[model samples]
Target chain A: MQQDAARLKVTREGDIVQVEFTSRKILDEGNIAEIGDQLSVLVEAEHRPRLIISFAGVDHLSSAALGTLITINNKVKNRDGQLRLCNISPQIYEVFLITKLNTLFHIYPTVKEALESLRSGSQAGRLK
Target chain B: MKHLKLQAGPRGQRQSREKSVGLWCTEEFPSEMSEGRRVEEKILSQCRKHAYGQRDLFALKLALEEAISNAIRHGNKCTPGKNVRVKYRITRQRVDVMVEDEGHGFDPAVLPDPTADENLQRTCGRGVLLMRAYMNNVVFSPAGNSVTLTKFNESSSSSDTPLSTTTVAFG
Candidate 1:
């Protein structure tokens, strides 16, 4: 009976695409698929070599969410672009470790850091 | 070392071999991960005592969780009024995990490939592929209402027979 109480915000500044996901739980397949569809649109748009994903409001992430992230990562990589994740909670961060995905993506402590890293093409404070 | 012979039915086929684990949940979507994790832990605990080691156990655990989540969330449509049933069977050579939902069935062959270029960014539809990669035998009921996954334990006796062959098949 619990509905998806989350919303995704998409914005673009210059060549950077910023996506913010606010959700209580990112578990449902439909919701995850929707996020993927929206992300693909943003990824295909012009002038965006950088993608910033802010998970400021997400409480937990399921495997489906992780899969979506991986899928997006692949898309971004194919274009020689970057997908940077910021504001990951401790709980969700642990999930990344359990799946060994933390090592596969660019995760930063804040949006500024992610944007700066992508903009500068520097590997500073990379996620292990 | 004791075994409980459940009635000669679906439940018995999955629980007859050893100390099995069963989870019954209302068809609520949000509980999918928790239910999946519960069964995953039970399976890990049971598989650990055998010779499967960490590598095979890890793959089996992931497959089991994915299958359970699919059954509860997609198949059941999160209808809390219905029920999702999960069961596990651990023998010396193989581990069998089954997840059944209280809903009509669908065609698994029609699902989009998760690895396709268009679907790579999609969040769903990866469960079936992942299950197939990790589990040795993946069988769906004719109606598509349930999935039974079997993982062969590496340390299993070579001469052991498949449980499914010994048990009666039901639609």
Candidate 2:
């Protein structure tokens, strides 16, 4: 499944859906709603999905953004799917650590690594 | 009306002179998401001009955004006629921010821990956590209608003294 929104661009890579945010700042409330709506469409689909969110462009993230990620992660899990995050900057990564969200989501250093792990069907080292 | 101003002498004065600029502003914004974003951008630009490091800037911006959004959304309940008041001060050594909403406050002690196992997958409770983690001091008014956040500049003086402190009146 593929989807596009104002700030989020979703594309399929094999069985894994890659969702990339186009905005540098993902803290706005409108952006949060748009992301949630788009991701919800993916999770509620008929097939179980494996997803990766690329944060290459996101430099600033707020609690709203983190909340959206948690909500999406739950929806994905409810459908027996998986979610991973990649390409996060150090500053954004610190926020995830501070909130202990790094424990909840599987984070990879790069999109390539995330895709490889998903393709290989190995869940090791994805969540640490 | 920017919230900060800096003044310094010529570079070749041969004697180092300390420049201090203090600014404070109080503005009432409609209880809307867009208004909160605007306030965040204004505050962030001021922080950048004051030479805050990238990590510090990111933390301040994120914390400020969370506080403003909380006031507009939860505190005011997005009421059209309601307004949120924001007061911020920026100086050479630190940044202080306060946000107040025209709504009945809740007890801060009752908030859930977002990092808890059962709550980790939840969405709504992380705002308060982020605010506390990023800001050096996060204090709420007795009624909980207002919050004050302080971040000390690491580049500022080495003394442990805080640049400024304000006491919020409790109801």
Candidate 3:
């Protein structure tokens, strides 16, 4: 069994950076770290810290993937930017619950809501 | 066999042992990867009920999945002609898992670090690192075709345990 087909994309809008992960399963090891570290390097080098993750394409995630997301969250936070997630599949939502990462990161039902939250600082979750 | 006793939580104080429970299975290569992960989780949860939570169950499960994935992918190379073997062992103090492949083994030392600058964005190479991190010990055979992993049933060897098992919204 090959648990190895996932694609990642990074884009930025104003101060907010959007990261899109498209895969059937992101549970494979080093997958999260590899993608998360790439995003961190971008933030560190380009100074575009704000990040929004779209999980619409992901159906499965594991502890390692959760760890990677946490690392990305922390990286953006340290740089005075925020990491937000949107459009998580219900199955993957169960993954967040199982791993209890759902409590640590901010997840929205839609991309628009996540973007709006970044524009308004009233939300308590953003790192900045 | 000299029974080695260990605790799972803060100290041995919270430990409880089960008398006898054994479950094992094996299959050929190219089977669904998600099914393998689900099997691992089920085994660990059942073991946890008999014993206490090691807090490392999640990590161990992930490690086991990586090892098996490697065996079926790199070892068997996803060739339908080849087979990957999976074995499960549970004792009072720990749980052991072995994933073996039919291919000629590769060198572990030569394996590139997945965290390296050049390899950071790659999807592979993190399996070994994760296997080592999640389990107490990760061992490979002389041929490197097989990897063995053992996870202690206790949490005191290190301070890491299961954290909030909570929800976070994005917007």
**Candidate number achieving the greatest TM-score relative to the actual structure:** 2
Clash list (residue pairs), candidate 2 = none
Task: List, residue by residue over B41-124, the lDDT tens digit for candidate 3.
Answer: 666776676454534565666677778777766787777777677777665456678888888998898988755556553444
Question: What DockQ does model 1 achieve?
Answer: 0.15
Best by DockQ: 2
Can you tell me the DockQ of model 3?
0.08
Q: How many residue pairs clash in all the candidates, one count each?
A: 0, 0, 11
Proportion of native contacts found in each model?
0.23, 0.87, 0.03
The lDDT ranking, best first, is 2, 1, 3
Which lDDT tens digits does candidate 2 get at residues A27-127? 45557777788778877873787989999978877788788888888888888888889998887888888888899888998888899888887765664
- Tens-place lDDT per residue, model 1, A37-103, is 8788778774435889898877645567788888889888888888899888776675565555667
- Candidate 3 regions exceeding 4 Å error are A1-51, A54-128, B1-31, B52-54, B155-171
Return the top candidate by lDDT.
2
- Candidate 3 total steric clashes: 11
Every candidate's DockQ is 0.15, 0.70, 0.08
lDDT for predicted candidate 2 compared with the true structure? 0.79
- In angstroms, give how far residue B169 of model 3 lies from its true place: 59
